[model samples]
Target: MHPHDKGKDRLRKFVARSEPAHPKLPLVHSTDAYTFTDALEDGNLEPRDCDVFIGEALIYTFYGRPSYRPNMNESATSLDHYLPVCLILKLSFAQDLKRIFPFDTGAFANDYYSTFMHRRMGLGDFALEADLDTPGRVITTFFGSARNYLHAAPDTKTQFDPAQFEARSYAALIDAKNSNAMDSRGSGIEIQIADPISISNWVEAAVVPSTFVQSETGDALRRLNIEILPYNVHSRMKPNEYMSTVTDACLTYYAQKGML
Candidate 1:
């Protein structure tokens, strides 16, 4: 059988098996824009099992099917824009993800964190003002091994683990007043996802919106090239403690796997 056929067969079988238990469950067909868009339009809101493939390479396994819930979009507040709302993946494929993608994690750390230096600043301003052209003022941190992936200075505080990663927003400066000056992109804050995939994969991971990744230099960006976040993902967060809570969650997953 052809490769595409095999993938579809796998997806169909997965969905067939999942739907018997979860009638509302939606198994994503492929990590492509059209596939996700069509699923959403078809009201396939609850994603069950999905395949995440970059080009022809399957790098990671994203699990944690949302326990049957309604599409509660009516009461969603601005906090939802910045919270870790997506289903977490085990990232059992972390090594493969980095190997196949081959990015300069160091450059991202230097540009997003060290160059701006906001670790002690405490998340900076809740609201930031900036665009694709400006440096984001807010700081968002993830719990996975961003430092290790980027090969920056070792975290001296502790040994590197795939379970611990951190990244801040390098797109703008955080300031409520200045936030009003920037265009209304998502929540006007940089999103910090801890253990990005280890937590939960976004419902719209494959069909990422254009606004989520606004880069000018044409040099590849981690968000667009690697993470493949949904467009406007910044606007869908749960608020302050969400980051920490998710970090702990990712750590727990790793701990269970004996990787931490």
Candidate 2:
């Protein structure tokens, strides 16, 4: 095989082995009601400059339950206060699209090294043929949180050797023996996709708060044939502890405006 073909073949196998057990696991993209409505009307999920993370759309995958859940960490306030929803993208479709790549940690965190890497190697760059030649240099899926590795001091800690990094799917974080990892909300992994994803072509379903189930937005979702999942089913859909107060304030504001 040609060198380029060999590299591509290896990369494809790597991604396949890394995937979660389910063949059709969906990726979750959290958003507010207004933005979701816009996407439905436009039939696309266009990345806004203000919301872009390293010049691509951000989404999350899970190692636990298969149902849809709201990611409260997506914002500083209660996601429900903003009439939050989640766009469910098919993982198979995203992988087939070839513009999607996974980061072993939350890409938006304040880790300096991770930030530098994101800037230096945009999502697409990590998957390039040249980068694939040395996959560990471009990708590393940690046994635990990558933060543990980043925060360890060089002299006192085990060094991270790029050549020794093992690339695994975010789903691999969970195993029958690791109850703690299984109980966590998510794998802390981030999946980045190239911009302007077509909603009609990519989105498989949506999760909306119960409040919006009868609203105009719900009607629009049905019209588009996107399955509507209520968020209350999943425990993790609740706002984080720190955001409870902020979420309450947002709820009040929305209620005062007669939006609730």
Candidate 3:
């Protein structure tokens, strides 16, 4: 097989591992902007998801899939717009939910508005004011999981023993990315994720150093290009803490394999 083809095969495996459950994954933070706009049109007082439709046109719709209860440590203030479309494009993209979330159909929504503009786009001020080091537990989780996957051997078979552990991590990352309350993109501006230098730092610092990651790291990056997108974006967190956590997680990995 061609070396590049070999690389593609590796990444497809890596992403497939941490992509989160595609089935009706627990929905959270998501709101249908279209439905919310209808409320605005008729002058209803009910709460809107993204402070989005207050204007004549809906800017964006935010959505989130709640994970680990409502108040996890990394969770930001409840009112913050976390579930910007960058996290889950499909979930945020609503032509019209044509349906309310399962069991709670209090409202229905569509993606028409959100597709063109994220709720964060409406809050241009808030996005600018957000901090740089916000815990952002969910996005961190996703970034870490992706980092972890990149750390895995390209040929490593998916193991079953670490299922729930893996789930929590992936869910955390996806959750943070989707949750509007804790994320910065809540302001509805087109945010840039890791700059070229920051992304280069990730590969050079962590991914390249992993025992399992080798030439495939750079290739997978080129193929997936998650670094460029700011929405579902995650960053290389605390160098010290990340080192400790990955060390512990790696120990667990080896232990599960009876390798050590």
Candidate 4:
């Protein structure tokens, strides 16, 4: 991913944070969604915000690959819908700063200047190198679609049609993309997406029927309907924060962009 495209300097650092923070992810590309996602769950990893950014990038990497037409949706925006994922990553970064640095400025503080540079980089200094060498085809396709924005139908910023894009659940999306395959050797990709607030109760949700929890969705996941715990992450918090942080941060970041 280009440094210009990444949201902000501070935010980009979080995305560059090594997955599992140990195995050293071998400079994978943002498009390698399955491999990258599988790693997040692999080992003792305290991922920073950048990990989630990588997650967002992995999903978006498919956007302009070969043809952004496959990536089209109702909106004309490129990766516009992914703002939620973006914001969530940033919030996690903010949280990390709070715990370790503990901002001297009040909660209202917003500037990157909040950081007091030291001899060495502080906790939030993340790198912004593109993990995967996103294929030229993908990059060209993504931009090509965006270039046709003006030719789109009313309110449509993109020229691609989204018949297959809408009206699909997460399960259907992954299955159609052939990303849902799981190997017995603890391989394949597991995309963990759900309401973060409800995640803490996932274990208990398993025991409690939807009748008790009042969630048909919960019942479905608990039973054979779908894999309740997708993804490799054992810690509920890991995926939970990943889901929440990206959703929240992207919303705010884009909303601010809209204003500008």
C-alpha TM-scores of all predictions: 0.24, 0.48, 0.17, 0.18
Clashes of each: 36, 0, 28, 23
lDDT of 1 by residue, 57-133 (tens): 22122212221112222344453232333333322323112111011122222333333334532222221221211
| CA shift of 205, model 4, Å | 8.1
Candidate topping lDDT: 2
Error of 4 at 159 (Å): 56
Model 1 residue-pair collision total: 36
How would you encode candidate 4's per-residue C-alpha lDDT over 1-260 as one tens digit per residue?
43313222442333233232111111101211222223223411123233333333222111111111111122332221111111012111111111111111111022222122223332233222333322122122222222221111111222333431211111122122222121110111111121121122211101111122234433433452322222222221222223322222322332443411
Instruction: After the best TM-score superposition of candidate 2, give how far the Cα of residue 182 lies from its true spot, in angstroms.
Output: 13
Please identify model 3 stretches exceeding 4 Å from their true place.
1-130, 135-195, 198-200, 204-260
Residue-level lDDT for 162 in candidate 3: 42
Cα lDDT of all candidates, in order? 0.25, 0.41, 0.24, 0.21
Candidate ranking (TM-score, best to worst): 2, 1, 4, 3
By summed lDDT, the worst window of 10 consecutive residues in model 1 runs over 133-142
Indicate the TM-score of model 4. 0.18
Model 1 quality (TM-score): 0.24
Candidate 3 residue lDDT tens string, 143-217: 333233223211123232343332232233223433344222221112112111122222111111232122343
